[model samples]
Target: MNLRSLTVLGAALLLAACTTPLQPGEKRYSAAELLALKPADLSWPATSTVGERALREAAVADIRARLVLPAGPEREAALPKLFDLVAQYNAEIAAARPLLLQALPTLGQRDAETQRALLTAAHTLYATDAAPLIWPLLPQLTTSKPFAIAAYTLLQADGAAADRLRVMLPQQFPSWADDARLTALMQRLRPSAAAQPPLAELLAAPLRPGFPVIVSLQRPGRQVMGLALVRDAGGRFVRDGAGQLFTSPQLALARSGLPGTITNGNTPQGLFTVVGAGTATNPNIGPTPYLHSKLPVEATPAEFEHVPAPGAAAWDEALYDSYLPPSWRAWPPIKEALLSGRAGRDELLVHGNTINPAYYAGTTYHPGAPQQGCLVSHEDWDAATGRLVASRQLTLAQTYAGAGARSDLAGYLIVVELPGEGAVTPAEAHALVMAAGR
Candidate 1:
């Protein structure tokens, strides 16, 4: 099959694995049966429709109860999948705490895959709570990059452990060191509260003119969260009645939870060319149309700037700096997408989530889930009817569409990591956009 067909098939299989439930009146598999089935056959990742919250909650509870099941092969095999469900839904992890604590002692005896999964689970579900447990097991799993990264996530909470992991980062994930941004990211986990330049200052970092742009502003930590502002071809922002720029909450967390320097990690902060827009075949993203964008190196500088091909330019220091203002060009954190694309991270886009928002109801970015290194705007879908209810992504697409008919749905997406701990509020975005305008 061709690449496009393969992509469709893969998305279909993933949607089936992650969301499809047993047909009406079909036999509901018991937890044991669920565990015995293959990856594609396990169907506990249920989606809730407009009014079926209770049904989905009960199903989640059933799966949570299995966390305390007798510790053995079944539990070991199920631990990763269970943790994934928890992360996917941002579900409560109180029950799984005991199970994770129980599994700690036997980690050395488990296979590397299981150990890595356990570490990942602890990182995702327990966070700092699992640090104490994970610290003791790191020596056993430090050789594996995935295991080390997951352990580092929890261990970073403890000062001594954080110091140790900082040293190991360069040694364990050596390739990451090639890009100074990845190394700097490890060192600056909790960014100092420095006064940031006005939004006008950041936007002054010159982008090619005459193309609509979607700028996503994220915190320095590269968390799966941020705010996205849309600009028209003439560099105008949509404003609220009060004349503040309209902003949408966008999630930039990648499913892999790795740094952007690696494949399938956090969304890198940089520019992307919006080459096309359309409905996604992937159920995880649902029916909302997404803007297909390509990063630098993924697209040549000519293509990236929407100009005719100049002689083949290398993705070197000069080319990378051309996209940034001279003042901000030397900063390493902002160079993530350039290095990420050079390192082979591709297929990035601005899209919406189909995963049920109830999964993340209590979280800060409620109704938004992590994507595969894409800028995901909040989108609510009625699972029963398979219909879009509300979508910030749609608004974004329409805004881009209305900007100009010249390229029809093509432009640029510039993602920047701002310096802050909280989500970028609409007020903040408005202030910045207005400041830039003035």
Candidate 2:
């Protein structure tokens, strides 16, 4: 071959060596090193939309064809070959992260039920990197204890036995949940789950699994304490009140803004029947709360399923809307101030599609903003039967969807369970109050 041709051939070989996986001691290149390579070093092949990882993967296929594996060599000898381009692999994966997160809304919402598949792709695509982006569970996702247990298990204080759960359960569970100790920890959390303010309401018609809800509260220094929990159906609680708080559920939701108001999304703690869900309402659910949705859902046998993890698929069956629910025939429309949940919308409504007296009282609504499309729960109930009736109070709030304040001073507020016999906690009583009946 001519000298120039030979040089070109040599460069191609060198590029091939840089894009594979190296187990440990092999020549691994960090993202910095890969970026420093000459254009000619790599084949300069067309890139994929999947970002760096896909690029590396595509390039690796070309390079691997030239390599030949031995029939039965010792594992150690073949190791370097395995990773000759290890750095490229790592870099590609790293680069793909922001891309994945940016495109998440489109991918995640294309179909709500398919979110798990999207998560799986996220797992395979991002791999270990996803752990740090630890998500806090949204109330709807609390329907599945296993998923909740597994998610909390992800945030191990350190890589203890508790951290190992990510790998054990069906290989589907994050290794963090596999730790025997962590599993025991999850089991321990069960007892306290029901009494926890969020847990009890979460148990009632858990919806919107996998959606993210920001739960934050201001601490002593104006420093906010909060967690972005993922929505799960497996709300933590056992029959007799003993369970673990979701990784940071208590710390995230516990807080108030003013001494006596439900500030921001700081839901007052207490036994709250998830009255119903409805449209986005601000300064309605909590004191000066952000715009959010609400829906009322009575647990239909179909909506109430036992799942290993809380997911939308759990509700794929019929809610039996065709048949009249025992309390189906009649109920008064909830008034504007009450909290009702909307089945389709998956949130507690404060008003049908309007703000409440509280927002006006609190000055949360900007005069020109037209109340920002907030809603309130109605005192909706079925009195037609004369006795207590099982009704699915519903509403839909699109709180985060609108342009509204994202952050507010937070405090440990709780939904105080009123006179009826039910679970109530200290925080709930002190910071929370039921909306004046509609």
Candidate 3:
């Protein structure tokens, strides 16, 4: 396998192993997965193609070494398109952002298809404006299958749109590296042939070894957590690895660190949820948090600077990860209807920001701290024997007790995901953990 095979999301799959060290190939997401996300914009850390790897290295460097503050529009204009890509990636990954970049070259040519894509994504990105033509512009997506498929994929991930691409990609998603595979999947989008799947096996659940079993998380408010995996004797999960734990001082800090505020080498620990997934920018760091949403889901090196974070002392000041904390949460049990396939050793995290004014202020379950940051694991087992007799696994840990504490040097929460199932619910889960404390 190439470097892409060893990409980050793979490694993240194993970090849920609380007591054990994070396994290799543990990652949050890959470049391909990022592409699939089709955020509002697109960008990278610049390229060898750009030649100038560093901002200063760019032959067309913008700011004079003296300009203390460079937020002026002059700076924006002088910055390389590559930098625009970088800045755009950090702000928001919504379709509008991507269209600004992906459709740029075509827009200059005034391609009708390009215009349609730009407009379609704009509705979601800039919802302020809407009129009679919003409906008509949509039909163009069918004519421009490539743009349509990308849009379809984004919404499907959000569970807000239908998988029209399914009508296009009946075979499989092609390789991101191999140009050939990509072409084949795209070619199938033509209007000539039957674009639907076979019928006989349609309604049936297609003997999926086993379905994704649900698991409710406590602290059921905005900060609710989620995942589905099981454990072994070594205090690790025996089956799937959705909640694999990374046992790094840096990672531990980030997990238990304060949120919104930048802190030490330690990441913050307030209430947070898994929003989406992405590739880790730091190769040294395994399985950074997975960030999602059609909006901003990344961070730049500058973000880790002398900011107020939990592990401020531990903050590297040198590295950053593409991963981000969540904005809202659905909890792990919802994945039962979301994720489908034969789950192997995998850890698919989907979280959101823990503090939501609307949900927390009004909802009954006000999940906070350890409960909000908790990673609920789901296990599919023999209903009777209670033995984890299936493939779907259980998440095996919980949040730290003193997650946000600046004191308690060695303080940490005793972990166990304990995804709620048959007899357990969010309230029940919390009560059990609380009782155990006694």
Candidate 4:
């Protein structure tokens, strides 16, 4: 058989293996059964009509139910099918946008929950497939909380798009017009006599040549789900070969547990470098063998001579400097304190957790779970037994840690707040080129 035929045959076999004999009176669909479904099976109406609204609602409900099933091979197998269905659902939404806009004349009249669902659909569709149709709707839809968050996120990922958004900002965010931070960033974004590189290119310009991994956490806040992106060897910030951005499959990082902060539970934003590495040794969560990269808060200025401090115009650097040892300079941690300007604590690390395997192993994590200050991988559960266990987080940690062992790949980790509400501060945006002699 040809490749196409072979692929179809393999998929059919995989789907077949996922099924089980039905138990009498068991109304719920088995995980395998769900995996066997296709986008066509969802019965989404082909055309935009009044009936399409109910169909959209019912389809999302079905997707969510299947998503909550115990994480396992079956669930994993089902995700591709589910994702396909989501793509179809999103296309339907995109087609129905004109109707959706006409039906809901004002943001106040739209159901908050439904707006959230549409926002989520747009985010999922764009992040994975780079669906272009949703772009025009994003600017107008920002009146909704969810839509605003997603639009900001999209702008961060595609810096070139910011040029278009700069024009719309005054209309979309009139109140932010006078905001100093926003104004500064807008000025920087203005087209100069000499053409400017896109933000993504500007961020990538500083990296040492070859395959160095850069992990960026954008807009990590109490209610907002932070996004993480990986810069692979090809210099592309992508999740996989499937062309999806690594927005989903991210950890709901803990709110700052630090006392006396703007948002007490907020995750502090800043540019951080990996200082050390190790594995978890806790007895209660004993012997979870994944690699962990340490972001020690107390590194001295002498250690980072290549990295300059923020300029005089930058935000409060003194506060970040306070987190360092007193023996270090009394000034801020970096020359520009960006998100770290207000940071009062340290010992932040990017590591996997073993304390609650079940919670981590599932597709999502409990946002309320506290952390001293760390970036963790989303835990994965076993497919067959539906038991919480070690997940892809361990794999990623191992991969990153292993890469760090190589001399050429040894690089810094920088954390910054998302660029909308908090503009990318000077400290956060500086080129992170590694030391030359190394």
The model with the greatest lDDT is 1
What TM-score should be assigned to candidate 1?
0.73
Number of the top TM-score candidate? 1
Worst 10 residues of 4 by lDDT: 13-22
User: Model 1: residues >4 Å from true position, as ranges?
Assistant: 1-77, 90-92, 98-117, 136-144, 170-176, 179-185, 189-198, 220-225, 239-244, 253-265, 297-303, 306-314, 342-344, 370-373, 380-386, 420-423
TM-score of 2: 0.17
Candidate order (TM-score)? 1, 4, 3, 2
Give lDDT per model, in order.
0.62, 0.25, 0.25, 0.37
Separate clash counts for every candidate: 1, 128, 87, 13
Query: What is the C-alpha lDDT profile of model 1 across 1-438, one tens digit per residue?
Result: 332343343334344121133224423222233223322221222244543464345435645655655767766666665665555545656767777777876787778667766766665566677777666666566444445455456654565566666665566567855654455456355443544434576664447677777888887655536788878778787665786676778888765465665544678877678776654555566555667688788878777766676744766767777766766665665676777777666777677776666556666655567755677887655466545556787776766666643544568787877766777777777677767772
lDDT of 4 by residue, 334-436 (tens): 1222332222323444544333232223223342222334554544333333233544344444444334434322344544444344322323322221111
State the local distance difference test value for candidate 4: 0.37
- Which tens-of-lDDT digit does each residue in 1-438 have in candidate 2? 332343343343333211111123323222233223332232111221233234344445533432333333332232222222222232233433454344334432333333333333243344345444434322223222324322442433234434344343324434534333233334433323322233223223223232223222212211122221112223211111252222121121211111111112123221112211211212112111122222113232223322235434332113322121223212111110112122121222122211112222322221111111112222111223211121111111222211111122111111221322222233432232121110
Answer with 2 or 4, whichever has the higher TM-score. 4
Candidate 3, residues 1-438, lDDT tens digits: the string is: 222332233333223222122245644443234333321222222211232133223211221221222444433222223222222122232322433443333333345444443433332233223222232333343333334334332432343333454443333333421332223223323322422221111111111112111122222112333222221212221222463222211012112211111111012121122222433332211122333211011211122221235333331212111111121122222121111111111122322211111212332222221211223222222323322321111112212211112111111111122333322243443343234231
Residue 268's lDDT in candidate 1:
82
